[model samples]
Target: MLNYKTLLFSLGIAVALFSCKNQETEKKTETKRPNIVFMMSDDHAYQAISAYNDKLINTPNIDRLAQEGALFNNASVTNSICAPSRAVILTGKHSHLNGKIDNLSKFDTTNVTFPQILQDAGYQTAMFGKLHFGNNPKGFDEFKILPGQGSYYNPRFITKDGDTVIDGYVTDIITDLTIHWLEKERDKEKPFLLMYLHKAPHRAWLPAERHYKEFTKKEFPLPETLFDDYTRIHPEDLEASSPDAASKKYNLDQPKSRKSTAAKTAEMNILTHMVLTNDNKLKDSTVKKLGIKERYLGDPTNRMSKEQKAAWDKVYDPINKEFEEKYPEMDDKDLMKWKYQRYMQDYLGTIASVDENVGRVLDYLDDNNLSENTIVVYTSDQGFYLGEHGWFDKRFMYEESFRTPLLIKWPNRIEAGITKEEMVQNLDFAQTFLDAAGVNAPDEMQGESLLPLLKGEKDAWDRDAVYYHYYEYPAEHAVKRHYGIATKEYKIMHFYYDVDEWELYDRKNDPQELHNVFYDPDYAEVREMMIKKLEETRKKYKDSEELDKQFIKVYNDK
Candidate 1:
């Protein structure tokens, strides 16, 4: 009986010790900070993303995030430009507050970014690929960034040691560098924040040889508003103002809308600006023979080596030869059709490389057993115009340029296949990240934490509107300075500086934004309410007319 009791006591002690060990493991798991993989591509249109719309191209890898995670339908940027958009994401503040309102302006180094905060909280931060503006980004223990609009092939990266050129396609090189850092340099004991940025599908789109061959042959459907002249003023459109008075004052025979002025003044028309030699890769001799003036003389061949040039010529020469034979006999409309095809081919080809690289990174996480404890985010700097309004660039408050694609996946934390309709901006990224890591966001950061929405707490999210402002006017593309408020139901904009115009649109009624109803008597109450809302939003964000004028003066001095 004594021997049996001793045996029982030994077993009980063993059970207690095992239970204590299990509890300690659970505590460690609970305390571990999730790793972050924030991926951003330059000028990647939401429409181009297959998850949002499969009409343009099929991006299986990027779409995988949306399938398994949360896809934000109303994700947008505070400013629809490159540097400013990135600044907003980093500082969790607007362009004005960050002091990077335009690409020309220098980034205010004093502002504390999310990475800096994360680094302070014992996180290992590393950034690779296109930082776009800054040579040395803050808070990152290691970074390899493109100087400025780095080349698509054999690009130079600015590292902590010094500048070095990597020999390969940029998209592939960036992915390789990121993976190398993860597999070799990463500390297994610490959580990490990794930023992977891409410069693909930006202006002067250059793709890898494999993608160039395939996408060039695949023709894409044109956007519905490809030929939009921006001049049509329907009878109902005129009813907003006194029709008789408007007709007499503005000449009804050729009615012009506000879009007409905005569109015509802007230089983004692809047909005129997208040169065949510079953009479409037609031979200079062929272009000369066709009596076409090439838009710019920036030939990618100048940067290519003998072998790289040979490879490029092997693919583009045949396509250019076919164009030379056909374009001579084609009319303006037919030429527009051809140019649109070429544009889609080169642009989408680069995106193909990006999609493939994204898959590689995701697979790295899955193979290494990091998916469950890592948060992967895929987004673009800003949305781009892909043949919409006959345009090809971004920098407007229009839907095509404003609404960026945002997808996030945090296994076991965020439910799969969730589609969020609430408006979220790049501005929310910093706070959202800090909240997820259990770190305190700086009080000066203007954006709200997106934790509630990311965790599928719809009732906890309460943003009714978003504010936007663009300051780079009298510059490239000539997009006028504008500020606006966008809600689920309406959008009100004031185009100031060179042009003083106020436009409002009922987002539900005019989904395409084909009409401006600011003066419509039928929408008088809505207009008043929206105006009040805009004022309140501006006040809340701390933007004012005085700042607008100050920025304009700063711009003028330049």
Candidate 2:
């Protein structure tokens, strides 16, 4: 009905309107997202980090994370094991819900993850280092992960297309690969989510050549319970004249006693932190000689090149010679002490490299002008026992292993130099990442978004406590199945596998968790209250004896 001139004019107005709408949508998308770098280390203990406790060792690089932003004073893991912790972080769900309660359980990648949410929301995602999940990772634009436990020296990494062995330390190599992706492969147009993981400071601690000799001579002060004789040593045995030399030699008593059947079964101790050929940097011949007495444990020299072995020999041969001369004559208690020192040295040495590499990543973000908009986080899978209770591994509900170091820096949104004492779990990680990208987390996700807490909304929300469950029973370390709830004031736990026992600790009076007052008459009222809370928490998480019974067959197979 209209003339040709009128029709052309109408078409022109419609084109202009559509362009403006599209531009606004693009701007909105850009404004909502922030780049994220999640830097995690395997088995790095909170006590070992200088930021949490400065008495043990210096960690200037990790301390920078705490200094620059918020440090979580009460960060914890639901499950203290490796792969289970990672699974909880990814899915924002508990172990039972996520179906990865223990290392033996597979991480079902089909479940929705925060990375998938971000990826769908137009964020470019990259993961480097130990993904730990056996299968190839999903929801990432690109990934290069270590195979199995991955090696310490010249580790092999599995990439999208294929696998290649990179010649360098694992921590250093991970950082190198991360920077490479940031510099070359990343899409400049999209915001990124990069998960940088480290394999050092895990089991069979192995340090790189640079840090091999570090902390070798320094004898770290032992934990008060490093020689916890379990009160088996009577007062008479403590006498100087006693024939029980081990009991008399190190006369010490735990402040308050809270013995459990599980504690009696614990097998992971500093003495159990055995040195190996590659772990101790010993020559194959030296390890064999130590094995003659059937005292030395673990496998032979790890896979390494001739040049690599020679370099290791240069550093450790002298130490091995000294140890070989002294160890046989030493008493059992003294031998345990010596082994503890060796374990700590190598463990701390590996951490030194991790810290140095952390500095590299921090530098990268700062140098590239990414610091302003990017969120930087440093944490570990869970806490490890640094000779606490004479132990070296994690998986205890004890504070030494329950608490982990968490430092997060978001320059634009979060103020620097803040510490939050609220109890936050790794389960909250997925929701937080989703919140950062302005993406809504699914209702199925169990963890509440930690964004409010991290943003200094101290009173914005209230979660009175956190729940924990561990189920790798009849497995390694002989740690029984346990579940508990930790409020700010108290922690109540029940170890139900192989034995039934309850342990309750008053956090204020005994922060070290040295004693359990589960049966004390003074705590009768509190016990009732905590038990009710524990029941509620269990119900909230959908974890109970019935659930375990349903899944018991799975773990039983092994």
Candidate 3:
């Protein structure tokens, strides 16, 4: 019964309300999807970062992420090796499922990555720095990666345009490219996922010329297990001369009468096989006086420009001169100690440049008011040894190399100054990204989302265990193939490429993992429990001896 004028007035009111509500919803949806910047360094150990352990070096800039947001106390990777770890993070599955079991195996581009999912969800995706995979990655819209093990000075980057040698330190160059992409190349309207990887603190650790003298005066404390004799172990019996020998039949759980081959490997010992001038980043003439033959001491700084080499000489010449004067009269023990010191100085020095560039990224985010809606994650491909167990490389399930550093900052969602103690692995990162963007993770993904843990809701997360597998054997460093399950209190593994051996550790009693307590009578109940758990974990991840054979076959064929 109302008139036309009143009816038109009421309809206009409803239409205006509807339009305003729609605008508000659109604005919310726009702000909800956070920009993810995952920053990673190669072989960066949790022990070196001040956020976890500050004995070796102080990493203030990297610590900012943990302080301003949340630090993951138990973050780890499915595989301990490099390329396989990277592949696991990209796909939310184990290496067995992803087909990237080791560095030798090419990453199957057919596998689904988190960036690919983000791209489908309307994100502007790009990767800068070392992807370290061949056949050119497919997910990122733009990629400029280091060709193989990139140089520290005048590093060459492989891009769609071809390989371009950029004249600068690799860390600084990578950061410059990242900033350029953010300011000039990236689309601001859409959310972005940027993978900024670094080759710093990797093999043949090289620092910038500026930081050569940074850690020269600081004498780092050696690891408690630095002189570990490998006497206390549970090694499998050697192959017998006769095929019918009873001892040849192995017992995987043999606890006593064990021996380890870690100290004998010539790949990464600071005292033995580490090239003098190359690994230590010293002058050639100075190293020559130490009686190290020129053939043994390779050149790591051959790629440095004239200016770069001059700056390097400015710092190293005096140090090397001092070393040559003192090393001649020293005995084997003193010489070994000197080598350890040199290795620590150069290794920690290279990390300083990484810390400096991280500060640059943090400052850029703060200055541009981009920190609030963006999630910043800092981690490494895998942890490396800082002379632990008389070794200096990864590819073992030991605690030093098993646990990587993981720090995340998301201002809008994750509360500041939070520490998540729940066990989480790199594989969980993919599902977490998908959940953040409101996209559904595929069923094939094997990891659970860490969204709740990141939000400081630890009670909501029930995962208390993680599985680790390292398959690179008869390769670099010569670590035997092993897989294990590590919970908060226990760790048990099988080193089973040729010989079968089971090792267990009570993390509470021996945090350093110095003793293999697989046969200790006190830990009998614990070992039985952990063995069952390991079996469950292997079955859950669909990792069996049969699948191991397939992975090994593919790796060998490659």
In terms of TM-score, which candidate is strongest? 1
lDDT of 2 by residue, 461-544 (tens): 598899998888888788888999998899988878576666788998988676676555566567678888888999998888
Report the C-alpha lDDT of model 3 over 20-46, residue by residue, as the tens digit. 999999899566788999999999989
Predicted structure 2: lDDT: 0.81
Residue ranges of candidate 2 with Cα displaced over 4 Å: 1-32, 230-258, 272-301
> Where does model 1 exceed 4 Å of error?
240-259
Backbone steric clashes in candidate 1, count:
0
Task: In candidate 1, list every pair of residues with a backbone clash.
Answer: none
User: Candidate 1, after superposition: displacement of residue 463 in Å?
Assistant: 0.4
lDDT of 1 at 467: 96
Better of 1 and 3 by lDDT: 1
Pairs clashing within candidate 2: none
Candidate number that wins on lDDT, 1 or 2: 1
lDDT, model 2, position 471? 88
